[model samples]
Target: LTFDDCNKSDRAFVAGVLRKHGFGATFYVTEGLGFLRNKENYVTWEEIVELDRMGFEIGNHTRTHPHMPGLSPGEMRKELLHIEKRCKEHGIQKPTTFCYPGFGHSLSCVRELQRLNYLFARRGVGPEFKDGGRGGRGPAYDPGVDHPLLVPTTGYAGPDWKMKDLMWAVDQAREGRIAVLCYHGVPAREHPWVNCNPEDFRKHMDYLGEKNCTVISMSDLSLFVDPRKGPEDPYAPIRARMKREK
Candidate 1:
């Protein structure tokens, strides 16, 4: 599972929960927002470093969260590069993985990311939520078949998510596929739309513990991906069509 946007107030709470469960998470941070000090503020550099000390993956979520598709190529590159630079300055390893701010993406931005040497850039929601249906984020992500830059999540667990939805996602991890759950703020009072109740979050963690599911940080999934294989060439189909036209 991964958490996005550094909510300062919930940092300790979220970290404590993960520690208790012996699980790790990737926290996608935006350092530009690190100045404010309140429930609505991003965590400080010290807190980010502490999370790193606790073994959580500190990933790039840009220097300031922005709509990627709307930014120029230079602007987009700055967003990613600045975060990578900040992580290193803070004694954290350069972030190899990235998450799109607001699920925004563009092919041009992707190209820039490749140039900057990011191993992965995640975007998009996972499965559809249904009532009394086969609840899941659809087919589990097969690194062999999917594009590395556009990893999908099982689903977004918000304030309204129930235990069943969480369990359904975990169950989908079977058959060599992974259920990547996207969580925003754990019980974020300010962002009620994406806020997941603290108790519910605990229940979800408890469920994972009871099921004995292996909860890994996003970076760890790299073990299963073969760098030799690489992501599919985006222009291959276009090139093929042009050749056929000839």
Candidate 2:
């Protein structure tokens, strides 16, 4: 499981609930989305440190959360480096995992992440699964088939996501496949499109706990798969899937 943005609820509400269930998750932090000016909606750097101390992985979501495809390579590097510098200042480990802001990604961004030595990077479900707009569904991460830098989100819990959608995502986690779920704030006020109610979030967590699912943070994937290994052609799996589907 992964929570995106620097939502204040991450420390206040989400962490406590996950602790209760003994589940591990990643919190992708960024100063973007008015995080610096808005204390009510976003978390402070100190709160982010507290999250790291709680043993949760703090992944990079860039500094400004720009549409990655539009940024020049140099611009992208700056956005990523700013977050890395901040994490170090707060004593958080240099993030080995990254999530594309707005789910906007490109081949250049993937190569950039690789250059920075990111072990894993998460992208929203797309191409493989026709994007259903906000909170879309997509295929599970098959390490053998998909590039580590192009890890696909199995489910994104936005307003449209329900218990049924959650069930479908988890059900896909079997054999050699892993389901990766993305979520914004629990009751994301500013971003209504990606908002997930606290009650609904709890229900989803409870379901995962009840079913004995092995929930893990994005960085935890290194335990099972070597980040150094991936398809020689990073886009090969995507093209293959697209062709097969067609």
Best by lDDT: 2
TM-score list, all predictions: 0.85, 0.98
lDDT, residue 182, model 1? 75
- Model 2: CA > 4 A from native: none
The candidate that wins on TM-score is: 2
Instruction: Point out where model 1 deviates above 4 Å.
Output: 32-40, 126-139, 227-246
Whole-model alpha-carbon lDDT for candidate 2: 0.92
Q: Could you tell me how far off, in angstroms, the CA of residue 183 lies in candidate 1 after the best superposition?
A: 1.3
Candidate 2 lDDT, 194-214, residue by residue in tens: 889999999999999999999
lDDT of 2 at 85: 100
lDDT of 1 by residue, 109-206 (tens): 77887888777667755222232222224335556555666666676666455677787778878777778877777765556667777788888899
